[model samples]
Target: MKTGTVVGRLWASKRLPELPAGALIEVQLDHPRDVIVCYDPMGCGEGERVLITIGAPAAWWFLPGQQRVVVDALIIGSLDEGSPPTMPK
Candidate 1:
């Protein structure tokens, strides 16, 4: 799992049918200044701190040995008012 913050949202009305129905948000990964579009079903929004599971781990983390590439990424959770206790300074 990776820690990040929602930087913005993307609107793609046309996509593959295999994709899940959710918001495609741009998240600023905690490490580098890089931003990535992540699928969010948890309703996270801009400026909201979030937990993201990327690639394959994001899939198998669920169950039944799901393919990580197919279910490549997800916004797992959103943080409230405080900084995450486990987050580095």
Candidate 2:
């Protein structure tokens, strides 16, 4: 899992049938400061802080029962408004 802010949204006219119902969003990672695209089934909007899952977990878990997606990244949850918790050193 990773923490990030939704920076933007993407539009696609065509997509795979296996892809679930959702919109593509761009997230700016808090740690490495890199941008990535994620599938959003929770209807996330721009500027919302979100939790993302990648790789196999994203493809397998973040969907309805017995269904799989082809996404590399998926938005799992949205964060509440406030400063994020500090990491222990």
Candidate 3:
């Protein structure tokens, strides 16, 4: 899992059928150009620190009988900024 802060939301007029119902958020990481669009199941908002799961693990997180989704990045949880001395970047 990766840690990052939610920066913005992405609105897509068109998307693939394999994509599931979720919000698309922009995450700001360590690198200057490391902002990435992620599928949010936890309903995270801007300025919030989050935990993201990437690759096949994110795509296969659904329950049994659910369709296999194609999520490259997924927001798995909201992070507690107070507990961590170092927040993302």
Clashes per prediction? 1, 0, 0
Using TM-score as the measure, which candidate wins? Answer: 3
Q: Candidate 1 residues 1-89, lDDT tens each?
A: 77888889998788775565668899988876589888787888678999888887666654663232355778888876786436455
Tens-place lDDT per residue, model 2, 1-89, is: 89999899988878887776678999999877899999897999888989999898888774576475678898999998895735647
Clashing pairs in 1: 56-68
Ranked candidates, highest TM-score first: 3, 2, 1
Q: What lDDT does the true structure give each of the candidates?
A: 0.76, 0.84, 0.79
Please give the lDDT score at residue 37 for candidate 3: 88
TM-score computed on alpha carbons, candidate 2: 0.81
RMSD of 2: 2.5
lDDT of 3: 0.79
Please write out the lDDT profile of model 3 over residues 1-89, one tens digit for every residue.
77788899988769877787669999986434388889998888888988888798877776454566777898888887653425343
Give stretches of model 3 more than 4 Å off. 31-33, 83-89
Report how far residue 83 has shifted in candidate 1, in Å: 1.1
